[model samples]
Structures are given as structure tokens and as C-alpha cells.
Target: MRKIAILAVGFAPNQSEITETISLLISLSEFKAQFKIFAFDRSTPLNHHELYDLESLNPKDFDALVLPGGIGNATHLSTWSNDKIKMTVNPTVEKIIKQFYEESKPIGAICMAPIVVAKVLAKHNPNITLGENFSETHLVEGWKVTVEKCPSTDYITCRDTKVITTPAYMNDATPFQVFTGIRGLTKELVEMA
Candidate 1:
């Protein structure tokens, strides 16, 4: 079975992060993949499955890596502003990402998580999307729900980098749409493996 390492950036994080990780997990469950949650925090939601600390994980052990969005404050941990401060993604995460890339393993990112990946692999110039149409608000009946801008059920892959990304909740998409996009990303990531 192929092993996948999932990092929740800052704990199973918020609702979005939890949902995103679970969504990815559910998607990957349909394949021949075994996964472990690599949380930034010391504690994670307890379950029959075991958890590992991100700092202690080695990229060599996992076939692929997945990072789900929900990094509200942890976003400050990464710096993509310029090359001078290229020391982003914290040391552990940076090393993990670089090692995966070096070994030609696939990596997947969803929603705002792509920023972290792009920032870490700035030199690679990864092709990613955070769900477009942010310029317009989605208006619906009953409530003023912002117009749903898409790329919802679609994903982007950086062929050279072997990195896959999708716009999960980035466009305020529905859970079904988010899951669809995530499933697509997971499919591509597993294929690359």
C-alpha cells in the first residue's frame, strides 16, 4: 500500500481544515493508500488510527503528501514575499516538501493551502489556483450568498513539480463541490504515485 502523509498546517485546525483533511482522507480511502495525519500540534482528534508529529516525519517513508487549508494564523509562518526571505514553510515542513520534490513524489494542496506550497517551492513556479471569481459576490434567493465562482470541481496540476491543487472553500463552494474537487485532486495525486 502507498503511504500518504497529510499535514493540517496548524492542528486539524478549524472546521474548514478538519473538513478538508477528512475530505481528502475519504477520497483517498477508495484507493490502495494508507494515510497518517501529520499535525502541527501535539494533539489531534483521537480515533482508532494513530497520529504522528509533523516534526518527526521523514519524507522518504511516504509515497505522497497532502496539505489541507485552514491556516488562518499559521499563514504567517510562511513567507513568499520575496527570495530574500525564502526561508518559509518552517524547517520541518520545508524539508519534507523539498525531500518529496527531490524524490519526485506527488504533493496535493487545496484551497488556501496552495499558497504555502507555492511559497515553499517558489523556484519551481508551480501552477496552482485558489478558486477564481473572487471579484464578484454570489447572490442567491432567500439570502445574499455570493455568486459561486468556479474551478470548484476542477483542479490544477504542475506537471513538472508533480504538485496538484484545487479550490476547495476558497470560492465559498458548497461541501459537495469541495469534495468533488478534492476527490479529483486525490485521484491525480494517487495516479502520479
Candidate 2:
């Protein structure tokens, strides 16, 4: 089974629903995957879901890394909430992203979650998006990434960085459209893995 690490790094309750949606879709796919939902802080669990401490996560153990949607990730896992251009990504989050990136492993981000990845891998300048006219387009300014406006049910997969991104709630999309976009993310991620 392929091992996929889903970062439950945000504080928003809806973030869990998005992550669970990704998990369920992946579970129903043909590729068999074992997931580890990691917590940035073990002391406070989100929605009572037990999370594996992120400090103990080893990038070498997983085939792919997933970052869930919700702007909460930008606020919590990264400093994007306050400093959009000069934001700083969490050390552990940065480490994992770099490791998976250096290893050429797949990394998937949903909605605003791509902000953290784009910030961490700024020098690499990969492509990502949060739909057209994203309210926070200013955040991508100094990140050095090429931002594209993909459809709500579509995703952008950077072949060079192995980074897959989708605009889930980032766009004014329906639940079905969000699920479709995430499903595309999972299918592409597993193929890359």
C-alpha cells in the first residue's frame, strides 16, 4: 500500500470535512493507500479526531504529502494570515515540503493550502492557484510561482515539482464540484506517487 501523509495543520473545523473527503475518495480509488493524518500540535486535537504528532513525521516514510484546504492553514501553519508576501512557513512544515520535494515525491494542496507550499518552495517557483481573482492574489506576488486560474472542477499538476493543486472552496464551487476537483487531485497524486 502507498503511504500518504495528510497534514491536518489548520484549526478550522471545516478543514476536517475537506480532509475526510479527500481520504474517502482516495479510499474508494483503485490504488490502495494507507494514510496518516498528522497534527501540528498534539495537545489540541481538531474535532476530536486523534492525529499523529507532526514532529514525529518522516518524509522518507510516505510516498505523497497532502495539505488540506481552509485559509486556516495559511494562518496557522504559515504566517500568510498576517504577512502575505513576507510570510514564514512553519519549520516542520517547511522541512517536510522540502524533503518530499527534494525526493521528487508528490505533494497535493487544496484551496488556500497551496499558499504554504508556494511560500516554502518559493525558490523553486512552481505553479499553483486558488481560482480566478482569488481575493488574496497579493499573497502570490513574492512567492515567485506562476499562478493559474483553473476551473473549479479542475486541478493544476506541476510536472517539475510534483506539486498538485486544486481550488476547492477557494472558488465559489458547489460541494460536488469541490469533490470532483479533489478526486482529480487524488488520482493525479497516486499516479505521480
Candidate 3:
């Protein structure tokens, strides 16, 4: 079975993105893929949610990495002191992503999560999508990466790297559309694995 590690915000994450992605992957019983959730340490115990500490995980143990989209992604995953200011990329997340990239493992990002990917893989200048938004697109382009515009029903897979991205809620897509796109993303990542 292929092992996949999913990164989520330590605080309130996009529950829909995480749950739906896991559900779709689980539905694909034939793929024989196993998944686990990891979050950064907030210096407090997670009482309501069960997640492995991101620091404790070894990227080598997983076949692929997944980043689900949500408001928390921008606030919790990256090194942002406030909504208007981003200091640096999270070292742990950056290290994990770089390890996966160096290993040629696939990485998937959804919605606003692509911003984190763009920062982590800045030198690669990977082609990604975060739906059709002026500001978000501009932010990604600032990283020297190309941001492809995709409909809610479709996803963008980077040509030069094994990075996949979907707009998800960024386009205000219907739940059905988001599910279809995520399923497609999952299938692509599984194939890469």
C-alpha cells in the first residue's frame, strides 16, 4: 500500500477539504493507499482532533504529500505574523516538501494551499493553479511561478514537477464539483506514487 501524508493547519483547518479528500481516497479501495494527518505543534494538546505532530514525521516514509486548502492554511501553515504580513515559510513544512521533491514524490495542493507550495518550491517555479483570482494569482506570480487559471471542475498538474493543484473553494465551486476535482487529484497522485 502507498503511504500518504496530509498536512493540515494546527488550528481550525478546512475540515471539508481534509475530510472530502480522505473520503475520496478511502473510497478507492483498489488503490490500497493509507493516509495520515499531521499538524504543526501549537504548544498545546489537540483535544478535539487527532493528528500526528508534523515534526515527528519522516518524509521518506510517505509516497506522497497532500496539502488541503482553507483559511487556516494561509494563517497557520506559513510563517505569517498577520494576514497582511508573511515572514517566512515554515521550516518543517518546507523541509518535508523539499525532501519529497528531491525524492521525486508527488505533492498535491488545493485552494489556498498552493500559496504554501509556491513559497516552498520557489526556485523550481512550478506551474500551479489557485482558481481565477487576481490577488492570489499575483501573489504566486510574485514567487516567479506560473499560475494557470482552471475552472472548478478541473485541476492543474505542473509539467516540470510532480506538483498538482486545484482551485477547490477558491472558485466558490459546488460541493460536487470540488469532489470531482479532488478525486481526479487523488487519482493523479496515486498514479504518481
Candidate 4:
């Protein structure tokens, strides 16, 4: 049994974090049956099987940590540029991440979740820019239904210097790209355990 941690925040991009997290967790079944999914925000929706707080979580107990995609992950759980001041992730989560790093634990973050990864890297190197690509719009039927851009880092750093990131979306105008996918980390992260 391997313990895995998944953070869920409130008010995120539809199908971003939830879909990705569920997919990653399901894929983990190939490795182990025991899992601990943690939802950080009180407003977050939860499955009966998932846990609800960081207070009870011990980084040592888990073999790996996964951060999923979402606007919430971008804006709240990662670095945010605001009014010339750069802000980073929730303090508690950051602390846990630092601990995970010290122990050389595997981490998987997708989409905006990488911003947190960038910050973690900065703590040591401070020279890495978590590159973000703009102009990636969600278009459909030749109509730009939604404009999507990562205002922060998309590649998250993990133990052994692993970085997992993606830029995926579905629509007629916004065609899919192979680089914009999530399953790649499923194999990498789960295999670490």
C-alpha cells in the first residue's frame, strides 16, 4: 500500500484538476491499492474515499505527491505575479513540498501545478524561469469560446529533478497537440513508487 496525496482547491477550471486527478489516481491502481487523496480547500468537492485536510497528512507516509491542473492551482497553489510583487503557493503546501524535497520523494504536477514546482526550484537555484506560453486559446467552430493561458509555470519539479507539465485542451479551433497531454506523468510518477 502506497500513500498518495492529491490537492483539491475550490473554484477551478472545469475538468482541470478533478479530471486529471481522477485519471492519475485510477492509473495508480496498477501500482498499489492504498491511496490517500487530500482535498485542501473546504469548498472543494470530495469523493467519499478522499481525505480533507493537511493537518493529518505526513509527508513521510506517502511515496509520492501529485498536483493537478486548474485555474485554482495556477492562481492559488503556485506563483502569482501581482502588482509587481510575486506571490507563491499556500504556506502549508509549500512546507510539505519542501519536506518532500528533503526526503527525495517523487512529485507530479500538471498545468499550473508546475508553478509551485518552479518556486521550489527557485529556493535552490533561483535562476529558473517557469516558462509560460500565452496565445493558447480555446477555440471551437472557428469561434474563440475561451482564451486559455498559463499566467504561471506549467512544469513542476520533482525529486531527482523530474518535471511534468502539459498544455491540453479540446475544441474545433484549438486542435490537440501531443505535447499537451497528461498520461506521460502517470507512467513516470507511479513507477517511482
Candidate whose lDDT is highest? 2
> How would you encode candidate 4's per-residue C-alpha lDDT over 51-120 as one tens digit per residue?
5676666888887777766666656565453411255567887887777667776767665565565565
Which is the better candidate, 1 or 2, if ranked by lDDT?
Answer: 2
Residue-by-residue lDDT tens digits, candidate 1, 69-108: 7643135335432322232567777788889999999999
Estimate the TM-score for candidate 3: 0.85
Q: Which consecutive 10 residues in model 4 have the weakest lDDT in total?
A: 138-147
Better of 2 and 3 by TM-score: 2
What are the models' TM-scores?
0.81, 0.89, 0.85, 0.68
lDDT rank order:
2, 3, 1, 4
* Candidate that beats the other on lDDT, 2 or 3, i.e. the better one: 2
Looking at candidate 2, the ten consecutive residues that score lowest on lDDT are 19-28
For all candidates in order, the CA lDDT equals 0.71, 0.78, 0.75, 0.52
The candidate that achieves the highest TM-score relative to the unseen native structure: 2
- Which segments of candidate 1 are over 4 A away from where they belong? 10-16, 72-87, 134-150
Question: For model 1, what is the alpha-carbon lDDT of residue 77?
Answer: 39
For candidate 1, give the lDDT of residue 72. Answer: 37
Residue 150 of model 4, lDDT score: 32
